[model samples]
Target: MASIALVDDDRNILTSVSIALKSEGFTVRVYSDGETALKALAENPPDLAVLDIKMPRMDGMELLRRLRERTAVPVIFLTSKDDELDEALGLAMGADDYITKPFSQRLLIARIRAILRRTEARAEPEAPDEAQPAAEPIVRGRLSMDPARHRVSWNGQDVVLTVTEFLLLEVLAQRPGFVKTRDQLMDTAYQDDVYVDDRTIDSHIKRLRRKFRAVDPEFKAIETLYGVGYRFAEE
Candidate 1:
């Protein structure tokens, strides 16, 4: 079972998230503060981390920034507010993905498993005698992306990502100007049989854009389609 850390200041949120992750067969560890969680990571890093945006001792964003400097482990933020600005900031700071308040357990499980699946897929060994490409070795100005190796590099440097993040980029790249509804992404990428809401797709995409934008200041590659869904790299 993959080990996952859950960091939330609220006891209820911690317990609920822990139970949800454990039910999915993950080895779950709960920390009520950023300080404790950070220390635990220093000693024994979990395969993935699910953090709350607001926590005592150190906020989620600060902890995430420090964590990125030391590890590329995936991080999923839990935020009560649904502000675009906060989502952008968290992603820019290196968060892999997130779940807003009132999200369902099923959706959370889907995100966790999807990320793990993608991470494992990307780590697969190369064919005998075939050399594996370096990480994020491709770029396309503000819209850098990779299809073969499952990575994306904005501008010139690598932007840390989880498996889900890379696949989301892939789906967007397949149709640059056309709108991709949330349902389309779910039908194409979300393997969970359960019908997860479109907001889940939106949430992950929001986080993905933040990280890309941090690397490219003019980044607006993933564009919203108002009442519909989203488009990518509009020509």
Candidate 2:
């Protein structure tokens, strides 16, 4: 049974979601605030986290920012229907996905299962050492991406990326100079069968650039094509 941490101030939400997840055979752990959730997570991480954006002391965004520093555990944000900016910002800050308030329990379950499936798929064991070359690292002008290891580096300096960011960057860097439409990226990067808007893709791209730029201030490997989409700069 996979363990899930649910963080939200609303007792009603906690009770409802916890019951639903438990019925699905998930070990549900509920926290009423981000501070408690964060402390518990650092001590023993869960398979997935569902966080509400409006928590006091430490909001979902802040908890995510701090959590990413310690673990790459997948996260899903909960936000109000009108919190468009918060949703985009949460994605930029490395959240895997977000669901607006008044969301259906069925939709939430589907999303959770999708993310879990992806996570499990990614963790599958690798082939024998002799067959390793088949999954070689992707190299592009000082940027290296190892899909087999799920690692990325710029100028030989290691950089951390969330699972979604890693998938998005891998898709672009593997096909340097090829423009990937927002829809294409959505299909490829977010394989959970969810419909994420173009703005979500934009936020992810912006954060991707920021991560690489931190290692190399002259990082220009990712380029935007104005009204079109984005591409990885060819060497």
Candidate 3:
């Protein structure tokens, strides 16, 4: 069974989400504070994490920042209804997704399953003695993206990206010079009916560029079009 860690200051939220996830056959671990969650996560990482952004002591953002330093476990953040900035920041900080408070149990479960399915699908590898070769890694200019290995490099230096970032980049880079509107990117990167907005997608794109630029100062592979969307540079 895939394991999931739930971190929230509210016991009720933890209990409800844990019960729902457990009922669906997921191994769930609960933490009521960011400090405890951070420690537990460092000691024993879960397959996925659900974090509340307003927790005491460390807060979800700090915990996530710390988490990124160590592991690449997929994370889904929980935020208040009005905390759009927090949600965007969480996404830029490498969270896989975020859901607002008073969220539906069904929606939460659906998001969890969708994320897990994507991660699991990517984790599967071809048999060592297989005959056919794997698909070639997508290469654009000085950037390289390997879907099978889930790796990205710029100018021959490694650049880490969350799953969402990776997927978004792939969607654009695969079709260089083809402008993809925000709606198209959301449709490509997220499951059906996911409510990601333009600003959220922009934040992820910004983060992706920042990550690549850290390794290659002249990174200009991703381009923005005013009043439209973005595209990967053809050259």
Q: How well is each residue in 1-235 modelled by candidate 2, as lDDT tens digits?
A: 8999999999999999999999989999999999999989988999999999998889999999999999998899999985758866887687877887898775577678867876786776767874334367899989988876667888889887756778789889888989998898888765546566898789879878877887888999889999889899998
Per-residue lDDT of 1-235 in model 1, one digit per residue for the tens?
9999988888997788788778778899999999988888867889889888887789999999988878888888888766666666787787767777877777677878877776776778888688666454334344566654555676567776655667777777766788888887777666778577777678678877877777776788888988788778754
TM-score of each: 0.73, 0.66, 0.67
lDDT of 3 at 163: 64
Clashing pairs in 2: none
Residue ranges of candidate 3 with Cα displaced over 4 Å: 19-27, 34-46, 51-111, 122-135
Better candidate by lDDT, 2 or 3: 3
Off by over 4 Å in 1: 127-143, 148-169, 175-182, 198-235
Instruction: Assess candidate 3 and give its TM-score to the true structure.
Output: 0.67
Global lDDT scores for all candidate models: 0.77, 0.84, 0.85
Candidate 3 least-lDDT 10 residues:
188-197
Steric clash pairs (candidate 1): none
Q: Pick the candidate with the highest lDDT.
A: 3
Candidate 3, after superposition: displacement of residue 11 in Å?
Answer: 2.7
